[model samples]
Target: MYYQVVKRLFCIAALTCSGMYAQAQHTAVKEPKDVPAEWSKAYAPFRMAGDLYYVGTADLAVYLITTKAGNILINTGLAGSLPMIKRNIEALGFKFKDTKILLTMQAHYDHMGAMAAIQKMTGAKFMVDEKEEDVVKSGGATDYAIGGGVSTYQPVKIDRLLHNGDTIHLGDMNLVMLHHPGHTQGSCSFLFDTRDSSRSYRVLLANMPTIVTEKHFHEVHEYPGIAKDYAYTLQSLSGLQFDVWAAAHASQFDLAEKHHPGDAYNPAVFKDRAGFDKELAELKAKYEQKMAEEE
Candidate 1:
């Protein structure tokens, strides 16, 4: 039953049941044409919470965490996202070059596109989960799920390796890494605390473990533990406790429904524990539906 569930998820969209029982090949995928234009669409950066800011595009989400020592930037959006990100940070009255650390939510092109350039410009150290270090360094060439013998984005060197439960401290800020694999082998979420005038809030920057493979898990020889990893990620996400939450993509967290451009600073808008649970359940149901359909 568990292997059946794993088969259902590992490559839910890869092939039909009759076509299962083969390993996933490291093949090349063509550039997709239907990519959302909103991915690169400029969004007015605004304060999300105490010292935390949203500097990404309308779809892709980039975050900035400020501290006395330096700032931490998460997710770089696209290869051309630097201009917008820089403007967003400077617009918030923060220096763009002051970024001391570069973090990633996932290793996909949309999230990691500008990492190399940004790291070069800011001279910030690029830290990634050890499990994903090779993929990032190979610039997606080593991505078993993505399955391309080519690089999707510019390669960047890793300065440090992060393991599950490691706390990254810079000045007074402490952000903990939660290994939530599946979307990518090393896909992860972040848990941290931030405060404003009202009170302190426990914030979760979730990676939203999405299964992106096109081959069956039993066949995906590149990532042997994908099935177990996805199970762990789902279970881990279900048990997490967070006062407020956001996801790697704005759409995942209903950013529009929560806040609009020029909206005043308020962290309460993100306090949607019920919504988070619903989203998680919906994702589960989606996979379950796919599983049933395939069967």
Candidate 2:
């Protein structure tokens, strides 16, 4: 009886320790090294522009951009993160009526999870790629490319279907759309040029890389053609000049590293055109080599 009692106590202790560990992980923040601790709240917020705010969620980030032309937003995180996003925007002293265009790169639920709600709330125009419109309307699934793998995502509609090389203007911003299809059939990106106080214009590239997640979050399978398209997509994009590159999960790489006081990664790592070319060449070489071996 004493042996059984001791065993029971040990089991209970083990379970308790495990529970604590799990809870800690659940609340942990997964962001670049520069992310501040205060940004670890359930729905932490960041400022991107004078009147624009951003919020980071588990797998996505939402931006609230306001302009004289109208209010524009980019990327809405997960469905559950909407309330916090709304609250964050409200705290910035703007009502939902102020939002105009609700633009997203793709139809991944995390990127567009709050689209329906935001559209309903602000009556904003949600724009997406024409190829992505069907997928969204059909409520189909997509393979988000992340690194070499893919993850699943739910479908959603794009109120305004966009095409490659199309320019959409908002206030003083002229955003050019680029169709980057390695991540999804309709995976696209946005580009815009901003003039600094020095009167020099710089381009901003908001890339939507193919996203892949672990099995726990894997909700869809990859499309067979995604790998082929990703290579072509990146190569085609190399010609564009962008001073900054931002994405959903990661921020502008340069900004992220710069923001981290002690981070080893430097934005200079990607600054060299030759070095960037070499990396791309190597990636394509590896892919070709693997394909050759299979053949």
Candidate 3:
């Protein structure tokens, strides 16, 4: 059964790779139409909790975590928003030169589109799970390139390969990596301590699975037994020692009003002990129930 699940996930990853890239390649040929209100030319970046920043986009969330050495970026915004991401980062009282690490939550086009651009701009090393390195280096697995509106991205060299339970260090910040396989074989979350003086931990889950149509799932190659695995991953992550949460997409669990900006109410409030326990319980029940339904 485990092998079946793993095989299913691998196949799905390949299909999603193709589908993702096709969209990016096509989308890159045209000027983005119908930009969102938050992404409007004059919109400003709002603060979330800690050092994380959300410039506002349905596709990707731009996070900046402050380390004693330098700030770390969680994920780059979508392909069409690279310039804005750069501008927003600059507006936040920091320069790209201060960015030391660029972490990809997963290899999906939307999450990684601006990776190459950000790396060039900031000279930060890129990190992804070793399992997905081949998929990423081969021009991406999900077939999409979210690397800013830029047509081409130099393949990102992996400076570090994160494994489950491995904690990544950035001066004062310690980001623990969790390899949750259901979203993508290599999908991961950067779990770390918040900047609060009290020093609580927080998790930035990358792309939480949405129960879109099966075609949508198949396009991304939803794995066969992954429904159960994803549930388990959530259950495991819920046990970790963090009280803050963020993701590449800002849509889950209402971490804040409008957006998760540092200046906004600290999203860490959701990561508190009570909230974390509640969220994990709810997520476990939700996904477990969904898996039974599929059975």
Candidate 4:
């Protein structure tokens, strides 16, 4: 009986130590040394649609959706992105502290690096797609594709777990969360409606599923379903209908060509259906080619 009791105690102790060790690793993490210049380069913020505004860098894209209750911030760019975001928000006459909810496009270190800091400062509830909860909480340390026990950002706590087709309610906004995994397990997109003085518009903040890992899905033993996930994301995003669309990166949607720094608040500037469709087709073609290579 004593031996059995000791065995059980040993198992409990092992579990406790494991959990503590994981927490320590997460706490000790910092971003990689090789920082991209464009990730932090300043960009002029502008209104994309009625309530949605651009508040990110020249390459990395972050968006703010204003509401009467508060505001919903989506996709805090790489680490150290808070100061820039703050400046952009202030430039647009919005308070950073007024952010009530935080969101993300993907769980990559670049996209989620500032989430923890922002959440701590604003006391905003951080919500993520159900599949991304673990990765976000772990600060990208637990990501299947790129995680190597060395984390890239401070871990964030999830206030709510979102699922596909979930409607996020914030004041007068009803942003629908679309789970478009494969970039990471829970990489997602947002779809919603907002209006200007002239007309209403449907806006899609699409999280494009650009493959970032090695060429072979079989190589990623951590995520056995990665191949299927990528296929699903590409197929799903292609059929989505929207009046205006933007992506996680400015170049992805051709921001410079569409809007200038001092341009007017014309939502029509983003109504490039042909551009979005062409990009989607090109991405789809690349995926098919990758699949062929895999075979």
Candidate closest to the true structure, highest TM-score: 4
Which of 1 and 4 is the better model by lDDT?
A: 4
TM per model? 0.87, 0.64, 0.69, 0.90
- Each candidate's root-mean-square deviation in Å? 13.2, 14.4, 11.1, 4.3
Off by over 4 Å in 1: 1-34, 290-295
Question: Who is ahead in lDDT, 1 or 2?
Answer: 1
lDDT of 1 by residue, 4-100 (tens): 9998887765665435322122223243346799999999999888878999999999999999999999999988788999999999999999999
- Global local distance difference test of model 1: 0.85
Q: Quickly count the clashes in candidate 2.
A: 7
lDDT by residue for model 4 (1-295), tens: 9999999999999999999867754586768768778888999998889999999998899999999999999998987888999999989999999999999999888888888889889999998999987787678888876777767888888899999999999899999999998888999999999988888899999988887546488888888898798889888988889999999988899998998889888888888999988888888787788778888
What CA RMSD would candidate 4 show? 4.3
Best by lDDT: 4
Off by over 4 Å in 3: 1-43, 55-59, 141-154, 197-207, 215-225, 255-294
Alpha carbon deviation, residue 196, candidate 2 (Å):
5.6
How much lDDT does candidate 4 score?
0.88
Q: Order the candidate numbers by TM-score, best to worst.
A: 4, 1, 3, 2
Q: Is candidate 2 or candidate 3 better by TM-score?
A: 3
